[model samples]
Target: MKEISTLRLAKELERSERTIFTVKELTSQIKDLLENRFLLVWVEGEISQLKNHDSGHIFFSLKDEEALLKVIMFRERARELPFPLREGLQVLCFGRISVYPPRGEYRLIVQRIEPRGLGSLQLAFEALKRELAARGYFDEARKKSLPAYPERVAVVTSISGAALHDFLRVARERWQAEILIYPVRVQGEGAAEDIARAIDNLNRMKDLDLIVITRGGGSLEDLWAFNERIVAEAVFRSRIPVVSAVGHEVDYTICDFVADLRAPTPTAAAQQIFPDRKQLIEDLDFRRRRLFELISERLRKLERELHHLSKRLKSPEKLIQETGERVQDLEARLRKALAHQFFLKENRFRNLVRHLEAVSPLAVLSRGYSVTRKLPEKIVIRKAREVRTGEFVEILLEEGRLEARVERIHPDNHLF
Candidate 1:
């Protein structure tokens, strides 16, 4: 029986006709290892053979210097990642170590991937810079808000670096610009995180009008502290417009692109931001002179108008001469009126004389007419009834008057 068992074991363990575990048992064991038996873990690795399957699963390899391990993250886990994963980049893999049931091959079911060193972070920085710059966030038009008069400027820089001293000396000399240092490490291990925190703290400062998130200029590698995605984001998102003077002007970085304004150096940033006292005074004087010149020119023009029209002012002598001329004209009109009146009076006198000659009793006397009157009656005796016999009578002759006594009277033959 033992010999039979040995022969049966050799046949069952054949490579071509190998006796394998049943599919259900194998899968059940895999589920137990992945969910219950094995510990959840994080692994360090580089990436390779990256495949984003149509079914929404990501497949890749995590490799070290000697060997490699396969990894897979479902769409559910892969999508939560902030950045894309690529081949040959080192990353810290977070997930459970497990195996596929069918092939019995081991792989990490990745829950998250945190990139190692600066490679992954640099990729993020470059990507974000491109994105924000595309949206005009880094535009010159968006830059603003120099303090009305900035006496205090808060510096978020490293105490270990030359930034604090350089900033203080130059800023003070230029404008007596004051500095309040929020000292932090500008490079190495946890530098980016500290820098971001420092920036946040300084932004809360009440006395500070403006903030300079700067450091002494350095090479691309030496300036890894500034190139960090966290630091760049902090600078970009600051409410107080940040002046980033991180590196030389020629060496443009992601921070330079995202900051409100970029200065070539720390000293240049200070000088550029602070107001110049002399220049402001000159501008004020220039405006005052312009205003005075305008007022003087207007007054001079009014004076010239008054001078040009001096001959137009009225005088008493001129008024008297004009009045005399008017009086002379009135005298000529009066003379003409008097002449007209004399002519009219002469004509009226001639008419009156002719009328008197025609109707006067003296004219009638010259025509041989007489008016007879009864003296006793004092009436004209044109008829006999007015006379009595033996009455005295008077005659009104043409040229003379006569008196008579009536001896007899005949009424029928009374004619005088």
Candidate 2:
């Protein structure tokens, strides 16, 4: 059917009376014309419907108050979008127009998409900030604390950048510290990766007390490397505290949120990390003077006490007499105490002897009580049940032991 139609159209055109085209030929021509003419165009509209395919293609409708246009974005272009596209979002789409022959439809093939009211970079920054914030990257509790006095510090930044010079000048002047500069690209391609790697390497060293990731003031694009997720993650994972001093005072980045300290500028970062030597010296001197005064006051108090004590002192002869009297009195008291203690001990010993006699079996035997034991075993028989008939038993008295044979066995419950 297609061939027949092509032939008919060709015959019609050859007659010179009219020009005709088959459906496929016409659609092809339209596709070519639209693609070539509108190679690049920008369209602004509110997204009404969006569909994402498994093939990573996006199909959506862009509609305004007056018109609606179908849009399609392929995988390569769609992946570059920093923020998600959704229905009811107003956006500016940049792409070319193309026609599909099978469906006989024309749609815009988008290469880029940006939120209508904001720049692409700004929108991207905001999107990333929200994502990382949700993951606790920007939490204050998660941020590390900077060193009070850093002996060794690392500055991860472009060696040639002005930030390094400013930081070093202020740091050197304020305090004595070991400064280690790790050179890296501050911006442009691969800058984020370089900064992250430097941070990881410095952390591995374990000698640095503080790390300062800094860059000079520049446009948003120029400062974007510091805002990357890789740099933010590196700063978050660092064992040593990190100080972020990127761009000017008004500038802020993801690194600033994730760092232990955020400095408005590179010079400020230095000031925070290093203490002023002159101030410290003055403080130490003041403390020393105060300590000296305190010691002098304590000594004067001791002298006063000594003087008071000396005034209470007596003549040597009188002191000796008084001491002799005290010794005599103590000796008298000691004699009396010894006699009293001896009397108490004598009474205690007599009482102990009485208690011992109360429990002594010999004393009981002397009182006419007898103890009996089975012969040969020598075990004291407390009950008649313990001795059987015809068993020889020994009787213990205060004077002598007598042996006898048990004639019968009997148990005395009342005696027990």
Candidate 3:
């Protein structure tokens, strides 16, 4: 298709010789007409010789496994490229198909070219880097400490990553908390969109006290997925706190800046958010033991002080002198109270004994009743055969107890 257009276009330009023309004039006309003719066609190929020119225009070749085409984009379009153009990368350029008469070679005038696998990530990185840098991730002061005792935590990462398992282990072991997962892909084409969606989902869950965005360590290109603008903005604008743990400690990305905290690894991130439950239990046990010891020591001190006070108390001589003065008064009061109290005691004594016996549990056994207790198991023997062989039994009969070992028992065969 390109070949046919090229042959026809060449002859059309050559026939224009009836009009006066210089070489420069012909090149300009060719450039203008070809540029106007084909606008925004999708060309898929591999980048072969990619170079950024001094004027900022990009010159490159797009080749497949079979053939190649020359491509050029002016500085304006070149500057907006999704990723750094490089040789050996597969790409799709949106551009006008054209011919340069001076070179007489067909070319693609690239408006914007996206690297097949790397474009979205590269675009995301560029966008997020710009925004977060403005918001101060690169700022040394903005980084904050991770939660040390998060009770409710959320994880935003692929449910399949080893990082998920690693983080879960650390969180459960350390905090024994309720962990909520807002799972998503951590890297690849739509990874940024997925991450942003997960963040948004977690934001609506009010009980989530902290969010952990993490993935296992990977190379720079792999980690670039986390550096996207939507993902970064999601972290920054989260209502609940966020902890970015995208890769290894050294692997920093845009999400790290916007997050409230940044952990070195997924496991490290979980550890940072969670307080060690075992350690907390140990601390509580120590405090309880200390309290018990303090109470025991105080009781001992009080007992010792009472004994010492008792020793200092004057007893016999002082009591005798005190009693003499009270004796005359007591004799006078007794004469008056004797008539009333002595008559009441005889009647009240029998009643008091009856009341005490009524309240006692043993009173039931004295009235032609015997209490039976079960052997070894200590169940009360409400029926005769409750005890098994080799069992010892106790019989309660009022004031005395009888112990007996089980003998062969017989049962009535008749239905009752």
User: Which TM-score value belongs to model 3?
Assistant: 0.47
By how many angstroms RMSD does model 3 differ from the true structure?
26.5
lDDT of 1 at 210: 79
lDDT of 3 at 410: 50
Which sequence of candidate numbers ranks them by lDDT, best first? 2, 3, 1
lDDT: worst 10-residue window of model 3: 119-128
Best by TM-score: 2
Ordered list by TM-score, greatest first: 2, 1, 3
List the candidate 1 regions with Cα displacement exceeding 4 Å.
1-45, 49-60, 64-66, 70-84, 90-125, 134-145, 176-178, 282-299, 309-416
lDDT of model 2 at residue 125? 74
TM-score, predicted candidate 2 vs. hidden true structure: 0.58
Cα-based TM-score, every candidate: 0.53, 0.58, 0.47
**Model 2 misplaced stretches (Cα beyond 4 Å):** 1-118, 313-320, 330-416
Q: For candidate 2, which ten residues in a row score worst on lDDT?
A: 114-123
Clashing pairs in 3: none
Clashes of 3: 0
Clash statistics: count for each candidate: 0, 0, 0
